[model samples]
Every structure is written in C-alpha cells, then in structure tokens.
Target: MADLIEKILSIEGGALAITRDTAAKLVNNLVQNGEVKPEEAQPLIDELVARGEAERDALREDLAAQVTTLQNTTQSIQTMLNANIKEAPERAIHELVLLGEQITNVQDRLREAEKQVEENTRQTLGQAQKQLRIAQARLVQATEEIRTGSIDEA
Candidate 1:
C-alpha cells in the first residue's frame, strides 16, 4: 500500500524515491517512539484541526446567543423595576390616605362613645339627688310630729 501511494505521488519526475526498506525502517522508528504512522497521522491531524475549528465556531455562536438573551432579560427587568419605582410614591400616598380615613373613623366612634358615657353618668347623678331630697323631707315631717307630743295624748 505504501508502494502504491508512493508511485501515485511519483508522477512528477525527480520526486523523492522511498524504497520498501526505507519505509519499513521509518515506520519502525515511529512505532518504537510511540508515534503514529505518517500515513495515518496526517489525515488524523487534519480531521482534528477541522473538528476543533467547528467546535470553536459553535461555542462562539452559543456565547453570542447567551449574551443577547441576557441583555434582553436585563432590559425587561429594568423596565419593570423602573415602572414600579415610578408608581411607588403614588401607591404609598393612596395607602396613607386610606389609613388616615380609618383613623378618623375610629376617633369619631370614640368621641360618640365618650358622649354616651357622659350622658349616662349625668342621668345617674340626677336620680341619686332626687332620692336624697325625698328622704330629707320625710325626716323633717317625722321630727315635727314627735315634738308635738301627739302620741302621748293618745
């Protein structure tokens, strides 16, 4: 096979001539050094270089796609955050207004309760004063009857 390949390459006159013995010696030397045969090495090296180039191209394309995707996602997130930031003060003011209204309602209810309690206290005090006045009148009438000695005449 090496002879046939060499013959094919020998079409051009004055090409380097490799005898079978020389070829065998070279192969032997390569094997002893744990190197691949020249016939096999060239094609393998070419194929590996091609494959490495293709892999690098694919990796570059993937990295570009990832960068584009990340940029878009970042922009979207920023937009959403910016919009939220813009509206935050308005939302906070609305919530504060609602809370204030609730506080006012609670204060009004408290004032009404206080007024009801005052009215009930005033009514109770008036009733107590009336009872005391009636008791004093009865005591005065009984003291006068005793001073007249009406019971002794009987």
Candidate 2:
C-alpha cells in the first residue's frame, strides 16, 4: 500500500495521470489490503480524489498560461516576419539602385581612361611625324651640298 502510494506520488507529471477514478481505485485497494478499514475508505477516497482534482486544476492552469505565452510569442514572430517580408522589396530596390549608380560611375571612369589613352596616342604619333620630317629635311640639305661645289670648297 505504501509502495503503491509512493509510486503514484513519485511519478513525474502525474497530475495528468491521477484522476478521481484512479484515486478511488487506489484507496479501495488500500482498504482491501487492510491498510485502511472499510469505515475509513470513503474519507480516504474523497481526500485522494480531492488531491488529484487540485493537482489537475493546477496543471491545467499552468498549461493554459504556457499556451497563452506560446500564442503570444508566435504572434510576435509572425508580426516580425510580416514586417520583414513587406520591407524585402524595398531593400532589394535600394540595393539595386546603389549597384546601378556604382556601375554608371565605373562606366564613366572607363570612358575617361579611354579618352586619355587616345589623346596620348595621337600626341605621340604627331611628335614622331614631326621628328621624321625634321630628319628628312636635314638629309636633303646634306645631299644637295654634296652634289654641288659647296662640298668641294669646304
């Protein structure tokens, strides 16, 4: 009988298992075992049943509180997700706009670099042509002096 009581009481989360019927049955078994007499059975049964009811009520309250807390947390998370979902498009657009501006800047810099390269190439070609012309004129003057009597007199 003591062992039975201990086993029932020692169970973890036993409030869900301990009902009025189970309490009465246990008390009846204790009476049959002569641990409790027939006259004492009713009071013991009532007390055990009441204790089970109290435990059940307490468990029900705790479960209700936990359910409410879970619902509130779920609502909060849903609201946050909804807000993020709403803002996702805006964020993407903002990022794309920034990327477009950066691309345009890069294109402009590339154009400027190309223009500078072309100008430098043109200037280099012009300088080379001028130098060639000067060298050709000097060579012609030397040829004329050699062909005429100026070379013999010098």
Candidate 3:
C-alpha cells in the first residue's frame, strides 16, 4: 500500500532483488498506462518473476538430467562397440545398406514433392494467364467504344 516496496524489494534475496525490482517497475508501468489494474500490480509482478525463476530452475534440472543420460548412453555404446569389435566390418556393411535405403526413400519423397509443386505452379500460371487475356479483351472493347463515341460526336 505504501512505498515500502522499494526498501524491501530484495526480500526474495540479493541476486533476484534486481530481477524482482526490474519486473516490478515494468509491471508498474502497465498499471500507470491503464493496461493493468492498480490493485493487481504486486500480484502480477510476483507471479511473473517467480514463474520465470521456476522455469529457469526446471530447465537447468532437465538439461542436467539430459546430459547425464547422454553420457550414460554413450558409455554403453562404447562398451557395446568394444565387445563387438570382431563384427565391426559386418556391422558397417549392414549399416551402409540401411543408410542407402534411407537415402533412396528420401530422394523418392523429395521428387514427389517437387513434382507436386511444379504441377501447382503450372496450374496457377495457367489461371493467371487466362485472367490476363480476359482483362486485355475488356480493355480493347472499352477503347473501341470510346473511339466510336468520339467519332459520332465529331
């Protein structure tokens, strides 16, 4: 209610005090501009800053978990590779066969998409050309009418 928020702006903590104060100032502007109501100011600021911090913390945790999972998976893959060292050549051949098949599939899909796009472009071009012809005919008819009218008046 009073102006004591400035004094206790960092009540959340030190580092986030700046974050909190900055958010409060921005939201306060919305209140001043009538975009946000005066009574809703403090709650809005608190909710926004808290939500941002929670999101940041959650992201950090998620990233750490993902990194750990990746490291574990890579280690497992290395162990498997070591154990299957004798079959490396066979595995390489099989993987190459699969990769080649995948490449062919992608190429076929890309060709189909390109053909569809070309057909669409051709249809659109035909429609545009037809419209242009119609417009030209109208223009010629209008010119002929104007010329005939001028000669009759003369």
Candidate 4:
C-alpha cells in the first residue's frame, strides 16, 4: 500500500509540475501580449500552481481510498475461500472459477485503460512541447526587436 501510494504520488507530482510549467508559460505569453498586466502575472501564476498541487493531493487521497477498498475486498475473498474449501468443495471451486474470470476481465480493462493513458500522455506532451517552442520563438523575436530598436512597423 505504501509503495502504491508512493508511485501514485510520483506520477501525480510529475503531471502537476508539467501543468504548472505550461500555465506559467501561457501566462508569460499573455503578459507579453499585453493581455495581462506584468504586475499581476506572478500572483496569478502562484495561484495556479497552488491550485494544481491541491488537486493533485485530492486525487492522491481518492486513489489511496480505492486501493484500500481493493485490498479489503481481496482479503474478504480469501477468507471466503478458506472457509468454504473443506465443507463445500464443489461450490468453492465454482466460486473460484468465477472469481478468476472476473479478475481476467478486470486485467483486460486495466490494460486498455493503461494504453489510453499512454496515448493521452503522449499527445499532451507533444502539445506542451509545441507551445513551449512557440513561446521561445516569440521571446527570441522580441529580443531581436529590442536589440535593433525596431518598432512594430504595422
């Protein structure tokens, strides 16, 4: 349980870090474009980062509860099997077979979910990278304009 919680926290932390970084970049772009005040950017960015961390903590708690429920269910199933094994061999075997089937179905669903998560993560990372590149290009352009003392010729 501890290991599972640790792993979940690590994944959630990474995701939240990426989200906070992306949000900061977007806010910086807004400041550059005069959509947001330069003085307001830091407070807004800090608020967003705090919100993301709070959300990550909430999700971690929910996942931990789910893990606990699963562990309890497994223990109950084991107890049931042990109690019935000698007195009701046939019924116990049938129950075990059904449990096996259910477990297999769950495993299949989990695999599908994992695949979807992987795909979504890939897409999100790609989009974030693209946004970062665009932000960098704009910064470079602004720097060149400053160096050359060129006003917007529009």
Candidate 5:
C-alpha cells in the first residue's frame, strides 16, 4: 500500500502521467489518513516537479530530432535534383513531387505522435483528478465519523 501511494505521488505531467495538483491532493489525503507523514508531502511534491521538468526536456529533444530528420530529407531531395540536372523538366518535377510526398509522410507521423502525447496526457490527468476527488470524499467521511462518533449518534 505504501509502495502504491509512493508510485502515485511520483507521477508528473507527461504523455501518461498525472498533474501536479492531483498528485498533491493524493498526498494530502494519505497524510490525513495517517498513511503518510505531513512532512513527507514537500519532498514528494519537489520530486514530482523535477520529474515534470525532465519529461518536458525530453519532449523538446524529441521534437528537435524530428525537425532535423525532416531537414535532412529535404536536403537529400535537393541533392537528387542537382544530380539529375540534364533530365527533362517534367521528369524532374515528378521526382520532386515524390520527395515532397515522402516529407509529407514524415510530417504526418510526427503529427500522430504529437496527438498521442496530448491525448494520453489529458486522459491521465483526468484519471488522477478523479482519484483525488475520491480520496477527498473519503477524508471528509472520516472526519464526519470522528465528529459524530457513530452514524447512530449523529
């Protein structure tokens, strides 16, 4: 149970990770329930923030690499055109169109990757928020129980 809580708190904003708000609430509930120490929340929050930063850095690097790949493909196509300078204009144009098609294909794949990342992040954040709400409800119930001593007494 402790391991699971720790794992939940560790998730950061990313393709398949939770938001910082949700993570903080989860920790808050665990602390309220005596499952975790109140003092522990700060360290966990710091760790999650660091993880988010790292994921963002990685995503930026991946995007830059994709751009570099597209640039290289474009350069290759240009080189091919230069090599075939003696070819008829119509044939050269056809080759250029084919190369452009290849570049477009790459763009499509990158777009798909971007969409997947976006959708996954949104879903994960939603799930985390839902879980936090459930945890908060549980905390409220526990508090009411303490105040009333028993449902019958209330």
Candidate 6:
C-alpha cells in the first residue's frame, strides 16, 4: 500500500512537471517562430509558469475551503434537525446563497484570465502580421530591382 501510494504521488508530480515544461516549450517555440520577441520569451515563460502554479494553488485552496465549509454547514444542519430549530430552513437558504456568490466570483476571475490571454494572443498575431507585411514589401522591392537590372546578378 505504501509503494502504491508513492507511485501515485510520483505520477502526480511528474504530470505537473510535464505541464510546466510544456508551457515553457510553447513560449520558446513562439519566440523561435518570431511570434514573440526573443528578449521577452524567458520572462513570458516564467510568468506563464508562475500564473499556472498560482492558479492551481488557488483552485486547490478554494476547493478545500469549500469542502470544509460545506461539511460545517452539513453538521450545522444536522444539529438544527436534531434540535427542531425554527430558523433551520432559513439558515440553509442563506448558506446556499453565499455558496452561489462564491461560485460567481470564481467564474468572474476565470473570465478575466481568459480575456487577458485572448488580448495577448491578439497582440502577438498583430506583430506577426506587421512583420510579414514588411518582409513582403521588401521582397517585392528586391524582385523589381533585379528585373530592372538595378541589381546585377553575379
């Protein structure tokens, strides 16, 4: 049983390591393909990793806290049921309302993160498009000069 647990832990750790490496590779590829500036690549990768880890940590903590809160609420409800409390139903309703608000807050944060990623992608694509246009123009100018004998072939 101990060995099995160790194996499971190792696999989980490996998965996280793989995820971090994959994120870094993606950023490096973007830099190599000129979609991201070379100077910004490392910092971008670092930020990506940090954000990912932070988000994962936040989610884990949130889940644990929610579970704990629910357990406490369940216990409280059980106590109320045993005691025949008059306000039990209202208290349960209040707890559910608070849980709904928490869910909404999490959803809002997720939407904001998604929007940030979308904006960054748009900026990168815009830069790539601008570079392509400049390269295309230069190619046309070079081709025209060669055809007009302005640049003689060696």
Model number with the top lDDT: 2
User: How many collisions between residues are there in candidate 6?
Assistant: 0
- Runs with alpha carbons beyond 4 Å of true place in candidate 1: 1-46, 149-154
Query: Which candidate, 3 or 4, has the higher TM-score?
Result: 4
lDDT scores in order: 0.67, 0.80, 0.76, 0.77, 0.77, 0.74
- Looking at model 6, report the run of 10 residues with the lowest lDDT sum: 1-10
Order of the predicted models by lDDT, top scorer first? 2, 4, 5, 3, 6, 1
Query: For all candidates, what are the clash counts?
Result: 0, 0, 0, 0, 0, 0
Clashing pairs in 3: none
lDDT of 4 by residue, 66-151 (tens): 99999999999999988877669888788999999999999999999999999999999999999999999999998999899995
Can you write out model 2's per-residue Cα lDDT over 21-49, one digit (the tens) per residue? 77777767878888878887776666656
What value does the lDDT take at residue 22 in candidate 4? Answer: 62
Q: On residues 43-95, what C-alpha lDDT tens digit does candidate 5 reach at each position?
A: 77666656666777898999999999999999999989886775668687989
Best by TM-score: 2
**TM-scores of the models, in the given order?**
0.62, 0.77, 0.41, 0.45, 0.43, 0.40
lDDT of 2 at 81: 100
Assess the local accuracy of residue 126 in candidate 5 as a C-alpha lDDT between 0 and 100.
98
Off by over 4 Å in 6: 1-84, 152-154
Tens-place lDDT digits, model 6, residues 102-146: 999999999999999999999999999999999999899899998
Candidate 3 lDDT? 0.76
C-alpha RMSD values across all candidates: 12.2, 3.5, 31.2, 49.0, 49.6, 44.0
Runs in model 2 with CA error above 4 Å? 1-33, 149-154
lDDT of 1 by residue, 112-151 (tens): 9999999999999999889988888867766777887554
User: Lowest summed lDDT over 10 consecutive residues: which window, candidate 5?
Assistant: 9-18
**Candidate 5 backbone clash number:** 0
The alpha-carbon root-mean-square deviation between model 4 and the true structure, to one decimal in Å, is 49.0
